[model samples]
Target: MICFFLFTGCEQVSKSIKDTFQPKVDTIAVEKQQIPDPVPYDAAVERQIEDAQRLVETVLEKHTKAHVQYIEGKNTDFLTNEKKLNRAEEALKKLPQYLGKEIFIYSSIHFYNEGKIRVMLQHPQNPEYIDNYVYENETWSDPEQLSVKDNIRSRLISLQKISFTNVAKAASVYNEKIKQIEGAEPITGIYISVWDNNLRWSPASINGSRERYSIELNQNGTLKKFERE
Candidate 1:
């Protein structure tokens, strides 16, 4: 040990000071925890969701009887590594309560955008009626089961994939979106949808009589879209 003293002798230093320069080695073997892959995010999903909301506004203007049930998609917030699925589970669970009895509900809107949008209100007791009125833009197709085409059959197949969806990591990602809107109000209705391998949902407050913000995410928790409806 080297020491510089103004006057005099060698004295004993504290044990903590000595340990600071010399660390003790451990003999135990420890296992490291494996981490999961990080979730992905894209601003495009948010934009698309927003666009869907705008369309809902136009749709409501012409048809006063219609309402935006819910909007769903997959998107992520890189900062928190969150799926940004905001209030998804809450909205999803609200749907079953809306369609209590088994009844085939018709589709009034079709998404011209990249992703698909399907609506269903069925005999709350049966699954067969869910595909009855499901259709594409301006063209109504019968429900079929196979092939990955854009027909109602493929849509049914997509809906069946929701069995693999998980919302254990859900959080509030719509707060900012709601605040960003011009005239958002208290939310009244929520809609849930199963699209292929994605689980879409939203926490929406009505902007007057229309929805202000909603978000969607894939089954893997990747955010697909965020918009107003």
Candidate 2:
């Protein structure tokens, strides 16, 4: 499911970028060349996956720097830049396979602010989630209620279990509880969900509403950091 969310709806995005960027170039002497045929879905998915990985690496570096600046209580515009968003969309266009594939790997950044980086990820077919935040105060939140030390441990265990069966069971029970809880705020943050093809990265339903999980990062290019639980 996580894989589907990350890989689907990319073709439309790529086409939009091509259309938006095509008009800005000098055309006086340039002859129109035949654009190559669109690549196969598999190929496009692979390219997008690579790009997303690269973006993660870049964010990791910048996030590390942002951590320090945030600690010093200094102003930094590390996370709100347009270039990073552009790069993120560009990378999303190249992701090939979803996380439930034999070698599915998931990593994403949803938002960055107040010296906090929110990360959402699922490894392979693992059902357990890694949802957490790193704050400028060097504090962290296990949004999933996972302990830092046991986070990956649970994920590793999930990979060996039967798919969806257990998750579905959990969801059935959780959903009932969700319905009973009442609140005006919409459930907007990430949680476990069955939205993707393989039931990966299942974001929980909030206030009877399901939300897409987001990973946020904060940095100033000099100090980097992150949080995953």
Candidate 3:
């Protein structure tokens, strides 16, 4: 027994009708998005080397720890002419053309060891890079960088010491003696090591036809010992 004329009854009935006929809206839950942080900068990538140039030059001039090796029956014209080999020479000849006026420091200069590749890291003005000059098909390719080793960091050397000049001189001084041995293959390798301010160079034949000899020189470049091994 409800009366439609009553306000409450009319309002309730209207609400009921609306609920029956009205369209429903659905709600969905959303998740918040998160963005990752970028990688940190490495200071070692730009770390500069120090405290070796002058000392290295002095060492080079001494020829104490330097080595000069000739391949079996190979020409050594490049050593005698003192042709463009050092960083300064490279800077003067190739860098100005390839890298402009910015100077490139040598990050990988060392004594000429046997079986070592003689390539320069070509990333101009950046010693931190590990890429070396690559030549192929009579054309020079661009440098490619690699991960620098943790233990063996870059060691700076002199710019003007004509790469392996002292070594060549040392070789010449001992070449006469090494070649003097009768009926033996010519020296195929020269190894020089310095210790206690003394220099010892061993010119090895390694061909089994001749014995290897170790020759030591004083700091003043005088012969100290010569022994057959």
Candidate 4:
């Protein structure tokens, strides 16, 4: 009877151990099954993202450092501060567009001028759309919309010289003018384009119901004309 009780007790303990360990084995198997395959990394896509991140960081650093300089009394020019603020705001506007977007280099064209290149980029998951970006003197301009037939490389080479800030200023002026018009919403984005020897600025409101307005800037960045459409 003693041996019988001892054997029964041992059997119960063994069963308990098995019961405790069985679930763990099952859980490990399930976890192994749930493991996902590694995603393939694309070097071109990675390079594009890194470039955009670097651009954002560079702009932010410029803004922050300018303020730091002012606070430390290294510079006292109020106009400079104002200009910096405007540039910073412009740069900040671009930040949201790049967030959560996949960017890839679509194409690149070298200009006759040394150190100048027109780079086309595909971004925002829209395979049909491409953007034109100008790179010169180690600086990159904000992207402009590029259509398949734009021939941006030749256009850039022939277009009259104009500062990007001038284009931005013209857009800002139009934005303010639109705000005073009845039923017009705030301008959320402005795209610059050169066609037919004319510089065009299109500012559209974030509100879907509002229509985009077009403004023409002269070669010198003067507001030549504007129209609602």
Candidate 5:
């Protein structure tokens, strides 16, 4: 009987050791089976991509010429001046590859005073791609890779509002003071110009003369400088 008991205890200890040392086999092979194979490149898609690239390049060249003409003071028609830019934007938007992509082309004439403009094309979905060009001094700069900020137009509108409001308030006070003087005119309107990230407001008087008020506004629409002429 003692031998049998010892034998039973040894058997239980061996079972426990084996259980502890045994490697667990994963029963769920679904994940391994679900791994997808790499997608093969399609010739049709490659052809489309090549066509789109050529279209974009052509549009960019045309846009550069139009901008150069404007900066050289040869084209004063606002609609004619923006025709190439509009065409470029339309062509880019129509590209199938650009669909559902965070692709944008932003053109701004206010970046420089000599009628110069900057065009920035960004594909945030593909960080490796960017095309930025500046047209100044009758030439287009080399393409540059630069990150484009979102909501640029909205920010500019906000800055314009802040600049106009401050200038209008100052002009009102000046008008009131001049009203006490004989035959003095009040400010009738304000024109806002944006250059070098600064807002300039020119207050127009009833007599047709104007004085400029230069202001700098922060990104959050706070006033950095409020100088009135």
Candidate 6:
């Protein structure tokens, strides 16, 4: 009788162990979070435009330094220290937003007399876009990018005759105007003026020899004019 009791107790213990070892099912609820919208290409385009402005400034700086050395017949520390100038040129070449296939890059001073300076990358497919650094007001998709042309002409016509400040001011104005047009609330349309002075070259003296001038813009950053001495 005691053996029978022992066997019965063992069977009961085995059943309890099996029940305890069984896996339990679990149910979990996870809340998903919503992601924010991505930045638009228009914003990227705007950023590119701003970058172009800075690049243009850098190009002017390099050109001016190189010009001064060439004019004075001085050994170009700039030419020897070609890292910065070369990088600046490369950056300009990459700036399609500003300098498109229609435009060409040339040595700023000698470019005037010399016709069609050599371009780094040409649009072989498009014969019209032969010059990668030159921009005609008549040709480009965005005329504002060609603001540098008028700016150059103005500097050339100045009584003082093509001072660094003149070029810088024009660059600043063009940049400011572009920013302004971009900032226009509704952006009905964008207009950039490249007016001609048609003034004869005369030897005029400037009071100060400052190489750059400040251009103040309206609401959107269009250049109103310069802060003259």
- Local distance difference test, each candidate: 0.36, 0.36, 0.42, 0.46, 0.44, 0.32
lDDT of 5 by residue, 79-140 (tens): 22344333333444445655556554432222322334454544446643556665554455
**Per-residue lDDT for 95-193 in model 4, tens only?**
455655444444322121122334455545565566666544445577776544322223231221434345446545655666756666543333444
* TM-scores vs. true structure, each candidate: 0.25, 0.20, 0.39, 0.32, 0.26, 0.21
Query: Candidate 1 — what's its lDDT?
Result: 0.36
**Measured by TM-score, how close is model 4 to the native structure?**
0.32
Error of 1 at 10 (Å): 99
Range of the 10 consecutive residues with the lowest summed lDDT in candidate 1: 146-155
Which one wins on TM-score? Answer: 3
Best-matching candidate per lDDT: 4
Q: What is the C-alpha lDDT profile of model 2 across 11-45, one tens digit per residue?
A: 77887898898756556435445456666678655
TM-score for candidate 1, residues paired by index = 0.25
lDDT of 5: 0.44
Error at 12, model 4, angstroms: 99
Each prediction's RMSD over C-alphas, in Å, is 16.9, 27.0, 21.0, 16.5, 19.3, 18.7
Off by over 4 Å in 5: 1-73, 79-85, 95-100, 104-117, 134-143, 146-211, 215-229
Better model by TM-score: candidate 1 vs candidate 3: 3
| Clash count, one per candidate | 21, 36, 0, 0, 0, 8
